[model samples]
Target chain A: MTPRSVLVAILAGRPNAGKTSLLMHLTGSPQRPINFAGTSVERVESRVVVEGTELQVVDLPGIGSLSALTRDEQEAIGFLQNRAAQGSERTVLCVVLDAVKLSVELRLLAQLSGLGLPLLVALTKNDVARASGRPVDATELERCLGVPVLEVNALTGAGVAALRQAILRRAETGRPMPLDIDPAAVAARVQPGSAAPARSLTDRIDAVLLHPLLGLPAVGLVLLAVFQLLFTGADPLIKLIEAGQAALAAWTVQQVPAGALQSLLVDGLIKGLGAILAFVPQIVLLMTLVTVLEASGYMARAAFVLDRALSSVGLSGRSFVSLVSSFACAVPGILSTRIIDNERDRLATIAVAPLMSCSARLPVYVLLIGAFFPPRYAALVLLLLYGLGIALAALVAGVLRRTLLRGGHSALLMELPEYQRPSRRVVVGQVWTALREFLVRAGTVIFAASLVVWLLSYYPRPAHIHAHYEARRAEVVAADPTAQKAALLELDRQEQAAYLEQSYLARAGKALQPVFAPAGFDWRITVGILAAFPARELIIPTLGILYSVGEVAADSYELGSLAQPGASGEGLRARLRSAVDAQGRPVFSTLTALALMVFFALCSQCMGTLATIGRETRSLRWPIFTFTYMTALAWVCAVLVFQIGSALGLGPART
Target chain B: MSHQETTLDCLPPGAVASVVRVEGEDQIARRLGDLGFWAGTLVEVVRRAPLGDPTQYGLRGYRLALRRVEARRVVVRPGQVP
Candidate 1:
């Protein structure tokens, strides 16, 4: 089959001009984000078949003018200039103009006209403009600007079909006409009868939402609701995913004979992939809420309210959205930093975003806090850990601004767009895109890392150890037939634990144990920490495997049982509690647990976050710098916690 | 009518003004002008942020938020409240 020739349509507009909504209407569903060549600036691209001709629509990043200031704006201008340089035969520039703000938006239209590309204006928000008593006539605008104009209401799908037809037609035969024009004059000409402006719905909404006394609290409530949804609302779904994964692994084990392939499938691939898949629910929920907030125009208002507070930490209000989102996951949070215009501010926000204590760290915290602290103090310690992350993030951002990323001012010049109902199509499309990106990462980098860790812990099974275990199993089976099953299972567990103790991973952990000695981590803890590099939540399962508690989900009630003082159960938490060192002393004291939690709170343990940082910045230096600084800080803080706690006599037997 | 010339940040909420000129050649000033703070353009001080630094201004039928540092760069002639 011959490939259909595709026509190109580039959507351009200033921020908050309803360009995105218009693009959503034109491209039905599913827009893919593609970075412009050689730069990190991403533009959403979609392919649509309009009247038998396939059309490729590219939504450029919003820009104020052709004379660009920020990197993203420069990239947009560069893309247009390059397209213009190439003889514009199959390309049409669709400029989205906000009808309510015709004069300001027309300025961009006039500037774009200078490019001499075939142009069409998509006039959006015409309904709102008309309700405000200053409606713009599309035909009059077409006559005034000497280009095709279509009145479009993106919310209700008004005039979308005509716009699509115009786009295709213009791409084929439209000619570039270089006509110098004044934007204000043209706007005035088009709107011949202007009435006094009535109080807008946006004004009434803002009067309450943006009020000085009530605005901050309202913003707080909104963020708190989002946080609550991410934190606990998705818990049941995450548990369901984990349960399904465990069931699949169990079913596989029962079907396949015990061998290397079975172990690899059940223990390595399925478990590793499931650990990430479990997060899909949280990611989808976060992306959906963020999209809603952004599309409803409430995000900008939130930023405006919080700008003063964030500016004290060398970040603008824009960074608040990214940082808050980091509390769910740092990968998406870092991606969201593109909203910030200042390069230095964006970079700084990206640098410290992971310190917001993402949901993945909750399992590790819960396990440790349950195993060590009393039930009464568990909540306090958890709160302290969260607070530690935020405090350190602020400190790091401030220090970075003063030193490495110095001299760039965080300019807070942003448009506070009028509130509008978020379009369902756009929200769903964005959520789907975020989910796909996350799953791709899980399938590639995380899958590979999981296998490597599995190999390291599975290899070099000496013949002597197997022989000894086999002999022990034979004696148990021979001595008592009735109790053989129970005895054999214990022997099998011990055999696996012994084999792991002698594996290459354990050897490396032992060799590096001295490095973590100040932080009170033994070889077993070291191995868990090392294996958790791929993803932070992997530490729970890694600890489970290392301690010979068998495979266990992170949120299993067995782990939670450790919090009860008089509870009786043989879980990973209990195993960790009773674990001993060479001197017959307990391996984990309360101080040690505190130090470990502190380390994990500050450490750069998640490879996904680092990889995202590299991709977002388009440089290896920033990620490397972030990894080094965070690790060093984590180590120092861990050492301090251990030393201080020990000096205060908070030892193993105290609790 | 004679009007008092002042920086944009000086106008109280609900005060109307006409932009005299944006006073700098830097990127911030250029961006301000691009957002429709040109000479003779009417602008109104809508409100200030809760912490009282960045203020919202209405111009060209849209609202914008600018910090005091950026707003202070735009010279304006203040008029009576609408």
Candidate 2:
């Protein structure tokens, strides 16, 4: 077998024309659905082998015309211009067209064809068009445009193989060739015949969907359904993932002897990463639902319904999709900001996007609330925390838009593509792509971060400490079988406590304690906060480790009175309830918990989100600005919550 | 009918018009043209947003939403006779 040169096949089309779906079908690559206008802000590449020929498919962002309107369109045009100038024999232009909107696509096709390239047109969505009794005549189109036109259904792989062969043949031809037909004359003959207008089914649907009175309620219901699917539908899958991780951890523990490597794998890497990985199901579900919404044409309608309210806060309607996705996880949410047309609006949206309470924060919030507050109040408290994040985000977005990101004239002129049945294949492809990307991107950062935290909590063990732990274990093993279990647990607790106290994390926490004192946090709370900056979910496992050493067993004591140990002793919650500061006042008071909740809700703690913002902006200025502002806001809000709550004498155990 | 010219935002819902010009001598006009709102194109106000600020309009076989601030920049002549 000989090596083949990579031939660049550029897939260009107007917005929402099934170009991405065609790409997925042609290359068998899982493509993410970005249905709204301007979402394809960058070029994506996929490699495929056809007849032993290597083809590098470059899917340029969708554009309305080669003339260019928004920044995204300009980018696509610029790429084409650059490629055209190179005059490389390796380049092949494949213009994708929506069969139902053939005339509209012809305008762009004509412009692209004028670039003097070996042009081939892929007429997509032929299934939908045929169902509507308006299937495009590929032969007529080819005769008119003087280019090879192939009808393709990306959903079912119809005509896909032939299209691939066509591309291979064109690349082999290896030269730019202008069409023999005149574009102006061809467009004039094919443009939906000016005498009779095509009244699409989309118009009938839009009559109710875009209705002033009915649209709002319908839009709200659609949004509610999406959120319900993301949160409730994904719950069981998340539990299953967590259970799997736990089983893996148990297996690892059974296989390895008690040593540093065992602890590192089981405690540092597994537990730490497992806590973060548990949210993948929710993110995948959100992306799938968003893709479906976009493909069905409702996403644009949703944006139209939301345009007024969003613009009031200095954001365009495009920010609605990105902001809502942030509730699942900020990394994908930040990436979705590509749909926003204006650079200033895009940056502003990215800046305040992380303020949405992500799934990562849910674990920490639930752990703290369940430990401190009653079970009956869980729903209300969770609602309040999410609401607080949203309110602060809106306020911050407004401020940023009026100041740093100011100066651009906001516009909302965007096309609402015709509605069609979302392909099941595309939806599945989207979910798979989102899951894989999240695992590769955010998952690695968290794994490394967990290892660093594990190292901090596991070093500098003195020989005497080891000797003391072994002696205690020996005494427990020799005792009566009835007391052996409890004695062994107590001995483990003592050993863990001693080891933790001498570790570097403890020293760092003690040094940072004074800085967090105003927010009512002690050294232990400070340690959790410091560790959680890399990944918000780390706080829960961090607290579990910290309290397991100093406290008794799990969930064995009452909430308020930590001193009253049950028959099996107390858990981490009881230990937290009974914890004390230097002045002997109990920590984890109701006020302090509220203060910490406020801090986590507002802070830019997730390294994944920051990294995404840097990648999207292609600059560090925005991420730095986001981090600095968010941290400042979090600190100020926490201080206020603590100070005011203390003044009012609130909390379970007031100092 | 009076020979009068008005911005697109002033047209009542359900009214039809033809775009006479895009007012701004800037990229906004060019962008509006690129989005199929060029001069001589037929346009009609389909509906307004719930808050009555951004209105949806049908043009060139598609629907688009334009806030009052942006709509005011497009000059249109009412198709109806007085």
Candidate 3:
């Protein structure tokens, strides 16, 4: 009935010392954020009960020396100097060091030794150093620093048991060894740290990743690979879900007494809900990839690459990581601005992060890109769209920082972790969690939102109004062989979508059609976009409904296929092709696609992202501003791109 | 060069340097190494990783790691290249 004594082990280290890798190995499987009571940085903690003692080992932020420059580094030092600061109050310090680079680390150890508190040195990356012919004498090093030093191969599970025992031994001791390191010596090393050396392998990696030429393309390539994988891998699963949804709808209609209730459940709820639910697989895939990237050292490098660039936009490079968090959902991403430590930078970062084109945007982008762009240019168009998002984010961020949130933005004082191969297990777990979250959202916000949109679109359904529809349905359902046979020719035409003029979604689309006409989007796209507001992936379902989805053979092009403009130019496909500007030429050209992608990527249309901003800031001002500005930006950008591009012979020149 | 001997630059990473300066800017640094570079103290670079940066050095019966970039920022004179 008693809780085990939770021993807190705080692992402190210099950058590139493989601290996280060691912690990952120490705490196997399903690692959660180890949140300290009051701090934003989760002191990476994992608890394990031993000998009736519950011990929590935290991988603290890497600090070069007790004398650090950045705020986080200072916090790390303060935590070590005063255990109460990290909230453990009784936490033990486990000084993690790269054996290959000991002398500098010893300074830290020496400082810890003086503290008189229980301290153990985890000499990590022994495998790496030993392979590279740089091995340290652990015993001698321990003797030299007057602290227990254990060799650990963080990559492999070597020496972990020893390290654990050492930690447990300290926890059992439960007494502080007062430190006595001369503070003067620590300060003498560097004159009041202006910042940790801004030049290191960390920043050098940024030089390439942040380069405009390679940066955008590299991002595009990574995104293309990830989405292509999602598109291909999720296809089979989506089909299964689609089949089930259809079967449920059919059964529901049979159970109902062929009245308004059946229509509401089947037409309004089923179609709209199905559209939103269908994107679960893609979201899971994205979350999985993101988790792996974050666990590996590459994500840190990404932040480093974007830091200077973000700074130019009145945001910190540290904001880059928070923005990346949006790919999962906007709530956490916006909340992650806490790490920014600067109000101006955090606000600016929050506003633009939604424009990074979160994974929710993935569904809409994929659908549009597949539908409009040629099959061969599928991935390229998708890539362009993502690129457009980043570009718009930069532009918007720059303007906001300069205009609204004016003043000096905090620069990125980052720790560049060494790159490592992503752990497959961690990624799998992340994917599982993301999938669970998506499903949960489906039943909550997305589900309710779907029902509402469905209700709005389904209500006031045109029943027995149109001559062609009323005449056709009467003849087909007459139950007489001659009546059905005579109506078969018209049956195909009736099924071709004469029913949409009767459905609820159609009317809503009709009302919104003129709004998007200037952008060359027809009623179908406008309806789809509206339905997708709650969940971007639901756009496909809205399109299916608008296009009279049921009769379209699932295996064939169905309602999802890219409908190109035919020579005749009459159908929905022709409308897409005939989207012309003032000069009367194709408007949806290559440049137009790029521009649309930019608009979509940067637009603040997602309700969830805005909701998240509102929640995090505890104010509607940010979300409202974010929404208005992004929409205006998207509209202007799209119009300019289409109009200018058409003039330069890019899109359909006439509307 | 006279006042620099007691500074971090006077004691660089690789070669042993007789600390000519010892005035520390803050307590954090002093607690790590010395109260600053001590005029009589000795420092020497012991090892560096493959990247040839973030070099470790031996001094005052303990080792300290300073990135090469940080070292360049610290002016040091070689007493004896160890």
Candidate 4:
């Protein structure tokens, strides 16, 4: 069929008007989010074939009116205007309206009707409206607006089929009619009672959730629960994924010959894949909770509850959602900033989001804490690292608002949608979308990065280094046959360490070592830090390789001293603990570890996050600014921590 | 009966009022108008946020949260609670 036979049905509505839910029902497919040209505003489009005619349903960013207020709203208006100009015969605008809030929503409907596009009304939440004694009569609405109106319950799938059929039919055969009815007048004439019940279910729920005395604490508890689940609840799943990856890597080693290809496949590709997969559990958990919160309409209340506190930092309540999402992963968090209407607030939120200590940083913190601090203090240090991230994020956001993003008064005008059961399909769809985007990044950017790192560490294998190790192995074999296997293993480790000492990565790390000397990091630690730029979790494995400990699972660093013999990651901790510099000075001290943790906590190391920031802001400038500022701040903090701790006799020399 | 006029921010929780007009030509004022805060629209102060800065208002069958700064721009005539 020609492309012209395909019909495009644009679902337009205000926020929380159930347009997304309705679109999901209509298409019977997961929505694909696409960025509009030259804008970061994402719109979801899904296609369904009905009766041999293709129908494309596009869910626009929700807006209050054609007179746009926010960037996304302007995007929606621009899109509609473009469609109108392009000749709207093949396009039908399906206006989704909340049956309970028809008066205000109808203002949008009225505005769209004036566009003279083929129109249809999908009145949602009829059940709630009817139960509240304010049911919208679809027949009366259809008569009044001179358009076919269908009442749809997206949750139960009631009336959805009829609505889909109506949309398709309207797109094919309907023509725009001049409608002269004022939305306010029509709403007043149809639904006369200007008063709603003093306490609806949502109101009652909000009464408790938004209680002046209890709301803040309630929000705190909710956030605590989310974080608890994200870190602890997903621990076992993360461990399971790590174990699976380790097993797969071991199996690959057994199947492949010992060569560069084997190392690349196991250490580079599989390890990178494992790093990507390791974050899935936490991201999935976080996104599921976030989607549920958003869908149930409690997110707005949480924003409201925190607005006053956040406003002190030049952020509105809306920034809280993005920041919280960043706690899981900054990629999704940056993407979610579209919901914030104010451009200045959105940019400020995006600027500080990466500082929220995402799950990727957990491995680095665990490795450093396990290596440096005592077991009892591990928890405290971890908490301090997380706190450092948050405190810095707040400070950075406040500073950004006062400087780069200053002077725009962000007025918080948000709709508190009626609380409903989070739609199962919608939640799953959202989680899937987040997972898909993350996996795509891992496959492309992470994969390429891992390959580049592998090449750097693997190449220039000088024959003399291998010959030296082979001679040592031969001498050990001749000297003692019984311990030949163990002796060869030692020689192999020495040979790998020797080879890496002169490799390009190590040379670069050494070149940059002086820059990081104030932070107490040696060449090896500098190399690990440099390698982790693409993904923060790579630091552990890179450190494992740098110390000649071989490939270690990113999560296994946590099992430090308690690890069983032959555990892959246990060797790295012991090596790092006893490792010394050229002058026989200890390479890593408690102060060094603290400085390193602080550096990791603040540095904008993740290329994925930077790319996402660039994409979201639609500019290279913001991402560059984010990188420069974060890196500079990290260096300053790391140096300060190192210098201050050293002066206070908190170094390895004192301990 | 005398008609009393005041900004929406001055209204107490549960006070019902009809909007007179959004007083400014700024984006926030136009946004308020877009959200059905135009003239003659009945709005109720549903509740205040926990910190009491942005307040929730019931208008046109939906609850909207507006900070005091934005609310201060909407002139309203207080009416008797039904």
Candidate 5:
């Protein structure tokens, strides 16, 4: 196939204008970042094939105007103006305007009309506008603006095909129509019969949502519902996936000949990928909830609700959205901070964003809590961990703002967009996009990390140990079938434990164990924590490997089974429970688990989040600062928790 | 003489005012201008946040919340005597 030449079609609009939805609908591609060839600036682009011509649909950050002050807005303008300077041929501007807020939207449109690029107006939210008794006449708008104004409802795919064709046509032969209008004068002309009401339905909704007495509690209830829906909706699917993965891993091990390939497929690839993909359901649900909240305009109201409290911590209400998103994962959370206009405020938000206990930390938390705490207290413990994350984030933000990024007090001068029912298509598309991202990362980074981990745990050439297990397995084969199977399992477990103890990873963990002693960590726990540096979720599988608990799926792995006595008359947990140092003191305790939880909650362990911080800030300094400070904070906090708990004799020796 | 000008932060809830001037020539002021808080634009303090530091203002056919510090930058004149 001949490579199609790419034409750049820039999609620009005000915040909440459905620009991203249009881009997704037009291209039918999940949102992917396109590094502009040879430029430092990168924007999300989808390769769109339109009428036998390939068009690169670049979705620029939403900006209010060309004179925008935020870095994101400036980048949007720079992308457009650079093309405009190069003579605007191969470039077309698709300006999406929210039909209900045409006056404000048109003001931005007016500024961009001077850019001298062929512009097509996508007047979105037609359904909402009509339902609210305010509809923009596309013909009238077209005639007034001297451009093809397409009335598009992104939700229903109305005018979407026509809009795509329009883009192609504009790219082919259209010229810049330099038409400008005084927004204030034209604002009154667009509304035909009824005057623009100062108190719209949004105000009434905000009355309740932003109310002093009910707003906070309403927000709390909404948050509870969001998480409840996420957990309940995703639990069954997670269980199903975990079971399938385990069964597949066992089947693959049995079917494949005993070789490195089988070990790689079963131990490294399957286990690693399964560990990562298992979180997809929860992540999808989270993206869906966030999309619904955002599209319905509740997110802005949430910012309004949180403005005062955030201000006390030197953050504006704008940081609320970013912080909330960080709970799911920090990459998108940092990306979402583009909405905050103030530079210092945005940086401060990004710096503390990873402390929000992202979903990557969820597996570790669940596994540890399930193992150490009772089932009845699971929900409360999880809530407390999440709450601790948020509290620490706020405290860190305050300190960072006061020291590193200090400046004028933050202002909450942001628009409260009119409430509209979230589009089902948009929410589905967002979830799909999030799931694709998760799978891609699992297929790449986690896959590689898992392979390395599997290799390290399988090495050091313990030939004698393998021979010994084989002899024992032959002897056990003479016994009954059940005894033979149990004997083989025990031999496998001993072989793995013996190999791991002599591996390079074990040596490194032992070397670092003393440093983590104050934090109540043993060599194995230190190894788990070290392995998690690439991604927080890796700690669970790492622990499974370190303890000879092979191929354990995080969601379904029974702690009781791991702790159950085997042929050696002791399980992994039993070994952990009885482990001691040179001084004959127990290595693991309840206090240690709590300290580890606190450490995971505070540490910047995920490489993706750190890389995202670097990309978003366009500097390595911030990411370095973020990693160093967060790690230091985690160490100190974990040490303090352990020391205090040990001093008070808070936890029993072994329950 | 200046029509008893007061900062937007001081305007009690439900009081309408027309912006007389934006205080600074900084980016914050320019952004406020971009958001339609320029001179002669009518604004009202619709409500205050729970802790009362940031106040929601109804202006230019939409509702926006501005902190007291940001609101202080906008000089306004009371629109009507109640």
Candidate 6:
């Protein structure tokens, strides 16, 4: 094919003009999620080769007549405003207009026309206009706006090539028939010399979404609904996975000989993988809610509602999106810090991100709450944990804002996106992406961690005892006489557990007890915490392994923890539960659970989050600092929680 | 020099100046529409919010937010704010 034109055309448009959607339609790449160099907010850039010309297309953040209401807006305006300063008279300013909403867009057309520069109007959503029976005569619209109007349907990618041809024609020719702009008409709306308009649509949206009287409650209810959906919707999926795990375990035990291989198959792979897999439901549900809210423009509305409060704590209200996601996973939540530009505010945000009580903590909380707190109060207790997390995060942010990272406050200046029903396809797309990412982590990182923990809990059997216990014991022991059989079984159980006592994870847990003894953590709790760092969901499986019940390992550890462990006997299980602590009370008390929750809430425990931070920041310093301080804070908080909780008669007294 | 950072809404309309300095928490100022204090670029105080938190201003044909305390930091020449 012959080259139609070799040219570089910069696609320009006002915001909400379907620039991004069109880019996606054309490029077929997810470049729409690229982060701005300094800002965490993503920018959409698409490259398309049309008839041999590779056009570098940028979806510039919308401009209001090259004027803005915020600093980021100014930066966007600068690129458009810089055409004359660059000593170039031919930067193609392709202003996009919605065919159906011509009146509102015409005002921008008039204002953009005054620049006395090259410009084109790509009339977008032509399909919607046509389907609504509004025939947009391109010539008449062009005459009315005094600019070239090209009809294009972003959904179908039709007329895009024609749009490119128009761009090429304009670029080759200096002035493509200047739009008929009367400065007087445009100047009437703007102040005589300033960009201040009499009123803005954003101001109207703010009146409703950010109203002091109604905004906060509205935001709370929205969040409550999101959490409720997560809890309610994830039930079926979680049950299905749990039932699958049980069936697999039963099948493995029946098929294999009653020996080491059967026990290992049932306990190691199936249990570990199943445990991590269970929480996928919560992650998927939470992400879907966030995607819908964000797409519907409520996320920005939330920023406005929380703007002043966040400013006082040295956080931008924009940080709310990241914090909301932190409720699902703090790892991606921290990586979202690219949105916050200031160093101090970023640090404060990072410190508090773990406080959002992410999904990894959900399974642990659900189990503990279901077991300990009454059903009527379970949700309230859950909310209380979330509330406590929010309060602690705010407190820490306040202190950091005032001290270590004093910052200039941020005022809310965000685009109030026009209200549209969030696309179901988009929400589903986002949820699928998040679920895939979560499973990928579970399969690789969590899978590996589970193996190490299981191994540590397995080997080093006392006095060279090996060759698979059930097999060897059957051959070597005398035929079952009641007294001898009981003695041998007890010896075998003790020897198997002793192997755990001697393993590295066990040794490390034992070594940390003195440090955790004040927090009411025995060696068992320390090992649980250790396993939980790679992922908080692992706490359940870690406990399972510590208790010799680690089924599905830490894989289903979070949401799947309540499943029956293999090789279970009611009497033996209760005996294990009643194991004595150094304080001569039963270990795993209510206070320990409370302390563990606090630690989970306060500590920056996810390795994936740390790795993401390192990737986003392109350095090790911030993530390292983040993980260290949050961990220290977690330890101190956990200790204080236990001490205070015990004194208040919250734990051990229940027995 | 200790730069002045004024809330954006408080700045009177029609004052022209250049952004000479910017100070406040980086993230906060950024959220409130505070770009860096580059050497060149016209800045103008445009409008104040009715609720008196974020004030809007025009700079280089764009409007952005500035809390009351941060607007004073621009340290601009008198001709740009308007």
Computed on C-alphas against the true complex, the DockQ of each candidate is 0.60, 0.47, 0.09, 0.66, 0.54, 0.09
After aligning candidate 4 to the native by TM-score, how far in Å is the CA of A427 from where it should be?
0.4
The docking category that best describes candidate 2 is acceptable
DockQ of 3: 0.09
Ranking by DockQ: 4, 1, 5, 2, 3, 6
Q: Per-residue CA lDDT of candidate 1, range B2-77, in tens?
A: 7779999988998888888999998888788778887777888889999997999988778889999999999999
CA deviation > 4 Å runs, candidate 5: A1-8, A24-57, A125-148, A157-180, A192-197, A374-380, A438-443, A467-484, A549-575, A578-585, A651-655, B80-82
Better of 1 and 2 by lDDT: 1
How many steric clashes between backbone atoms does each model show? 0, 0, 57, 0, 0, 58
| Winner on DockQ (4 vs 5) | 4
Q: What is the lDDT of residue A120 in candidate 6?
A: 82
3 against 4, candidate with superior lDDT: 4
lDDT of 5 by residue, A72-138 (tens): 8878888888778888888889999887767767778888889999888999986666776766677
Please, what is the TM-score per model? 0.95, 0.89, 0.66, 0.95, 0.89, 0.70
Q: Write the per-residue lDDT of candidate 1 for residues A402-512, one digit (tens) a residue.
A: 999997767988888888889898789777877776676443677778788888888888989999999998888788989788778878888888888888888889999
TM-score of chain A of 2: 0.89
Worst-scoring 10-residue span by lDDT in model 2 chain A: A551-560
Count backbone clashes in candidate 3: 57
TM-score of 3: 0.66
**Candidate 4 local Cα displacement, residue A338, angstroms:** 0.3
What TM-score number comes out for model 5?
Answer: 0.89
Colliding residue pairs in candidate 2: none
Q: Considering only the true interface residues, what is the Cα RMSD of candidate 5 after superposition?
A: 2.5
Model 6 C-alpha lDDT per residue in residues B33-78, reported as the tens digit of each score: 2232343345565544434455555542233555565555445555
Global lDDT scores for all candidate models: 0.83, 0.76, 0.58, 0.83, 0.77, 0.62
User: Model 1 clash pairs?
Assistant: none
**Higher-lDDT candidate of 2 and 5:** 5
lDDT of 4 by residue, A1-655 (tens): 4554688899999888888888888989888877644444556799998877788899888888777766678788888887787777778999998888787778778788878789899998888888887777778888888789998997887898998889878876656866776778787666656333224888888889999899999999999999887877788888899889989989998999988989899878998788778888889999999999999998999999999988888787988888898998998888788778788988988999999999889888877777777778887888898899888888988998898898886888899988989989889988988888777754467667877887887778888988887888888988998968877877787788787787888889999999998888999999998888778878887788677776664545653332343345556777788888778878888899899999999998888788778777889999999999999999999999999998898866732
TM-score of the second chain for every model: 0.93, 0.89, 0.55, 0.93, 0.90, 0.59
